[model samples]
Target chain A: MANILTQNDIQHVDYKDIDLLKQFVNPHGRVMSRKRTALTAKQQRAVEAAVKRARFMGLLPFIQK
Target chain B: MEMETNLSEEGGVSRVYEIGYLIVPTVAEDSLDKVVGEIRSSIEKAGGSFIAEGAPSLMRLAYDMTAREGDKNVDYDRGYFGWLKFEASPESAIALEESLRTNASVLRHIVFRTVREDTRAKIKAPTLREVKTPRTTLAAPRREEEVSAPVSEVDLDKALEDLTTE
Candidate 1:
């Protein structure tokens, strides 16, 4: 199945956009990969980078309690 | 984890980096600016020039950070979050990280090589200062007394009070 990001025709994922990235992050604050999220390989890579950047900026946590 | 280098418009060797750093929330808004200034100065000393993305915003931490103060454990619940994009060489990146690590006001910081964009930043390195002192303005540089003195809590109180009065 095509992921929602692609279905909606979103081009590049933004690391600073926390609201959009939150959907792909698991409860534990980890970004889900293509296997679980069904994102295209390219999109998955973008999401991965976005999530990591968000974590470092404290928009998201390394681990959630 | 991988370092990618590219030529720039100025024909100087420079690489872009994404820097994310956290400041402890206990610092007053006045002192916070000082902390940021110090960090930026260190970055300049290490040959990195800051590219302003935006102003940093205060944020709540996702997990509790408990640390031992004098006797009781203090929880760092909130922090000032900032993101910066800068251009520098690989060696300067190391120096930048080291400076951030030593500063107590910085609770956390991370630096990584970001994918380069088309915009080019001029590459120039600042001279190394022999005396390590907390810097202020350019005029007169600093006072003789302040050069050897450390940042005292009384100064912090004065700065914090300024926030309320004005």
Candidate 2:
């Protein structure tokens, strides 16, 4: 599996402040489902909403197809 | 003196009332101006004294209505906000509400009574508060609370014993 946390691992992906988002997210890029980043469903939703708002405001890049 | 007594005894013919309505977004902007003009005429005809008006704000609806006549596939409709404050008889408000309910242009309407003498007085005589109040410092209260708590006797004894031993 490609390393999700590393910016280099995602090819042609659009992300606003890739470094900042990486720092906020888990090392695996996948949040939760692990003990190190023990975030619940609510926390996940908050993160998703923040990311969506950032994208809509042009602060973050939308994921490229 | 007899006319004044009769007028006072009859409970007067005036009351301060507020009417507000929301216009559907589908209504053209030009149509909105026309609707407002009609309302102005309606108020004048009803013998209501217009006081003030509130500006429009874009707000989300609590629920979506699927049954607008012109809109076939409307997921939702935008509400154009408006408010009118006036002095009129209670019966006039009832008549206005009935008219608004029958009108297709209005998305929602409500009328409320404002009878507080102080509220009306403030309208006529404005207060002078030209200067904005400065925000108070929060850190000062925390520091004062910390200083007010009594020191533990055990801790004081321990400090004195350490000094003597040294």
Candidate 3:
């Protein structure tokens, strides 16, 4: 599968963009692996960091339950 | 996490930091500005200069969060979210974060080093690509089988007879 960020030409992964970030998170509220997300290593890192930040801000949950 | 700070030749250290905070939802709409202003003043007091900011707006939380209010822990399902981007020395930024932790009005906050440039991606609807059918004038060359003329009944009978005989 094509890398979503690369396909969209998204240069920055922002934690405030919950909708976009949700694509990188699984239903369990865990960040998906690079193989699953089909993201470059750098892109995966950025997404992971953004997801963690979003979770801290209560914009995203740490766990679904 | 290790803090990243830029040290100038003059021995001064500073870094660009962005702080995102959640204000208690109990604050009245009219007094929201005052709470935001207090945050600004606190940053200013820490010797930080403002760069950009997002005003606090009421938003639903993903989960219930509890914050101490005087004598009791109050559960909140919503909050006023805001952020400020500024330049400050590493020491002062840490100091400001410590102060915000103790602030009763602010339920949660985070300060992280970032660049001055706007790195946020604009949310936009995906554009649908137009599907174009091949034009008749530019149609692909037909295969031999498809381009071949239909066999006459006599020719078909002759071919069948020949096959049977073989």
The fnat scores of all predictions, in order, read: 0.17, 0.00, 0.55
lDDT of 3 by residue, B3-108 (tens): 3477755587989899999999989989989988988898899777898999999999988899878799899999999999998888888888988888888999
Window of ten residues with lowest summed lDDT in model 1 chain B: B120-129
What lDDT would each prediction earn against the true structure?
0.71, 0.52, 0.84
Q: Which digits, one per residue and each the tens of the lDDT, describe model 3 over residues A11-54?
A: 87777888888878889899988888899888898899999999
What is candidate 3's CA lDDT for residue B120? 74
Error of 3 at B18 (Å): 0.8
Which regions of candidate 2 deviate over 4 angstroms?
A1-65, B1-12, B66-77, B116-166
RMSDs, each prediction? 23.1, 22.6, 9.7
TM-score of chain A of each: 0.89, 0.43, 0.95
Model 2: per-residue lDDT, tens digit, B63-159? Answer: 4534356656454435666767777766777888888877777766667565322221111112211234556754345454445577799989999
- Model 2 per-residue lDDT at B66: 43
Off by over 4 Å in 3: B1-10, B125-166
Q: Would you list the rank order by lDDT, best first?
A: 3, 1, 2
Tens-digit lDDT track of model 1 for B71-108: 88778878888767888877778888898888877778
Give the lDDT of residue B84 in candidate 2: 74
DockQ of 2: 0.01
Worst 10 residues of 1 chain A by lDDT: A1-10
